[model samples]
Target: MTTQPDHGQELIPRPERTPEAVRVALARVAPHRISDMERHKEQALTAAIADGKIGHLRHWLTYWQAQVEIERRPDLSARYRAALTAVHGTSSNDDPAFRSAMNELAAVEAEAQRAVSA
Candidate 1:
């Protein structure tokens, strides 16, 4: 029912109604619509596919935290808390804020492991 602002043609619901809620949604499909993304979409798709695969990372992290001695290792506790906070903050994996939180948590695990050896 919606008409173009300048033209007499009616707007199609698919393109007009679909809001780009996530990067993957925008990258995989919206790329054709956006001139700037015409060059970057393939790269974005590759990165998005890899990034989307959590593969029980959150579960493993929780297990690592519980199995490790957090009382003796403060670093482990820090990682546990970081993961908990990250998971609690958002459910959307594509969200920028959530990605930042997860990246911070991912680093915490390595830092904790280093502490165990040191």
Candidate 2:
């Protein structure tokens, strides 16, 4: 099993980036989102099979894998939601708070991307 470095501390086991793995992780971390996950999986599978291209399915798996990583970390998940709320609460994109919230959201997303890609 592959392990990811956790800030020079003990290595964290990296979950397999597969549909089954994602489902299991979702069950453990976000059980309520399982149906949504299944819907996305079905859509990705249908698109891939119809087009004879696996890109859509692969993209779906990667996206969900990143989401699983984010959800696994409570701090990251909370920060992500808070940043989203801040961004959504703003009336105008021109507002400084909006930009700050967007930056925070992007940073959290980047962390998730690293977690998955690692």
List ranges where model 2 is wrong by over 4 Å: 7-13
lDDT of each structure? 0.43, 0.80
Q: What clash count goes with each model?
A: 0, 0
Model 1 CA deviation exceeding 4 Å by range: 1-71, 74-79
- Tens-place lDDT digits, model 1, residues 1-118: 1222231221221122212322223343334434443334454555557888543443333333222323223444456677768777896888787878777766666554443333
Candidate achieving the largest TM-score? 2
Q: What is the lDDT of candidate 1?
A: 0.43
| Tens-digit lDDT string for candidate 2 (50-71) | 9999999988988888777778
